[model samples]
Target chain A: QKEVEQDPGPLSVPEGAIVSLNCTYSNSAFQYFMWYRQYSRKGPELLMYTYSSGNKEDGRFTAQVDKSSKYISLFIRDSQPSDSATYLCAMRGNSGTYKYIFGTGTRLKVLA
Target chain B: EPEVTQTPSHQVTQMGQEVILRCVPISNHLYFYWYRQILGQKVEFLVSFYNNEISEKSEIFDDQFSVERPDGSNFTLKIRSTKLEDSAMYFCASREVGTGANEQYFGPGTRLTVT
Candidate 1:
């Protein structure tokens, strides 16, 4: 099985709607979870970061990790057209190295 | 806020030719990394550098690939002999410290096309 799996969603939602993106992983050692936003032809930018399980909120975005289920999620509240982009979920083990494993990413569109 | 910067936003080269992608990480960052994303594929880690040496590298990082911190500010990834499969977007990332908890900042990336 792939170490990390994410729906390659071209998920479209209306402006002001709530958007939830998720990823599942097989590695139980992964301790740090991150969400990145990437526009077409642009680099991935850090959107939200969380360590271990629980919920982390930053502005309109919230990141949740369920280590027991090996699942992670990023939720965008009050989505806007400016929020349209591919969301990539990345994770790394607790080792003191920066090696990261990434999901295929989900494409999201927030319609105006 | 400091950000990583990559140069030659796009590059096209002939197969078997050597190509080097350059990046300037955040000045205070102590860890550097290289990752690549092939067309329609997930981003994959290539290698990580800290304390002037490789901390870890994925299997995809073969002997043909090499990374260097040639100067105080610049980090580079060199593909000795490019293959068509080498065509992908290469990203440079850096973190303030070599810790699993620190957030990494990524550069825009360099799109390499090996024909």
Candidate 2:
């Protein structure tokens, strides 16, 4: 099984809607979870990062991690058309190697 | 805010040709990484560099692939012989020390097209 799995969604939502993105992993060793947004042909931009199981809020984005279930989520409040991008979830263990395991990104489109 | 930067926004090379992708990581960051994404696949980790040496590398980072930190500010990924499957977008990322070390900042990718 893949270390991390995410829905590759072309999830379309109207502007000002709330958006939720999620990822699941099989590796319990993963201690750091991150969410990134990518535009077409661009790099993955860090959106939210959580050290372990808990919720972190920053601006319009909130990140949640559930280590027991090996699940992580990113919620976008008041999503805008500018938020249209592919959301990628990445995670790494505290092994000190610092290599990240990434999931196939979910494509999001917030229409105005 | 400082950010990572990569050279040659796009590169086209023939199969069997050699290609070198370069990056300049955040000045104060101590760790560097290389990751690649195929046309529609997930971002795959290639290698990580710290203290001027390789810390870890994935299976996809085979013998044909090598990474170097030739200077204090430059990091590079070299593919000795490009393969058709090597066509992808390559990204460079860096992380700072101390607080929030796990937070890596990524640069705009270099799209490699191997024909």
Candidate 3:
């Protein structure tokens, strides 16, 4: 089984809607959770990062991690057309190696 | 604001040829990394370097691939003999230390098209 799994969602939503993207993992040793945004032909850029299990808020984006359930989520409030992109979730074990395991990104399109 | 920067936004090379992708990580950053993304695929980690040595590498980072911090500021990834599968976007990343945080800043990436 893949260590990290995410729905490759070509999800489309209208503007001003609340968007929730999620990923589930099969490993319990993962302690660092991160969300990245990637545009077409560009590299993945770090959006939000959380250590262990907790809720982290950064303006329009909120990242939550549940280590017990091995689940992580990113919520976007008031989604906009400019927010359309692929969101990838990545995590690494607490071993401090910093080698990340990434999920298959979900594509999102917020239409105006 | 400092950010990771990569050169040669796009490269097209023949198979079996050697190619070197260069990156200038943020000043004062202690950790550097190389990741790649194939067409319509997830970004995969290749290797991580710290203190002038490889800290970790994935299986895909085999004998053909090598990374070096040739200078205090420049980090590079050299593919000894490029394969058809080597066509992908190579991204460079760097993270600062001593802040009790490890969030990497990625470059725009160099699209390597192996012909």
Candidate 4:
């Protein structure tokens, strides 16, 4: 299985809708979990990052990690048109090598 | 609000030619990395450099690929002989520390087109 798996969602939602993006990791050793937002033809911008097995909130975004189930999620509250982009989930092991394993990003479009 | 910067926003190179992509990471950051994302694919790690050496690299970072810290400010990736498959978006990232607590900042990226 791939180290990280994310649904390649071309999900469309109306403005102000709640958006939930998820990823499943096969490696139990992964400790650093991150969410990145990428625009078309642009680089992935780091959104939220967490190393624990709980939820972390930063403004309108929340990142949750469940080590036991190896599941991670990013929640966007009150989404807007500007939130239209590809959401990528990335992680790395604690081995200190610092190479990130990334999932195939989910493309999201928030319409007016 | 210092961020990583890469040179030549877009590059078009012929196959079998050598192309060097350049990046200047955040001045205070300690770890540097090179990653490539093929069109419609996941971003794949190419190599990581710390303490002026390659800390780790992936299988895709083969003999055709090499990375160097030419100076205190610049970290570069050189493709010895470009192949058609080398066309992609190359990103440079840097982290303040090895621990997972810190976030790795990324550059805008250089779009490479190997024709």
Best model number under DockQ = 2
Question: A30-92 in candidate 4: lDDT tens per residue?
Answer: 988999999999888999889869999999999999999999999999999999999999998
Candidate 4 structure, TM-score to reference: 0.98
For each candidate, give the interface RMSD after superposing the true interface residues on Cα. 0.8, 0.7, 1.0, 0.9
Clashing pairs in 1: none
**lDDT, candidate 2, residue B51?**
91
Candidate 3: give the clashing pairs: none
* lDDT of the candidates, in the order given: 0.93, 0.94, 0.93, 0.93
Least well predicted 10-residue stretch by lDDT in candidate 2 chain A: A92-101
lDDT of 2 by residue, B1-115 (tens): 9999999999999999999999999999999999999999999999999998999898999999999999889999999999999999999999987755788899999999999
Q: Candidate 4, chain A: TM-score?
A: 0.98
lDDT of 3 by residue, B1-115 (tens): 8889999899999999999999999998989999999998888999999988999999999999999998788999999999999999999999886655578889999999999
Shift of residue B95 alpha carbon in model 1, Å: 0.4
Go through the candidates in order and give the clash count of each: 0, 0, 0, 0
Off by over 4 Å in 2: none
For model 3, the docking class works out as high
Worst lDDT 10-window in candidate 4 chain A: A92-101
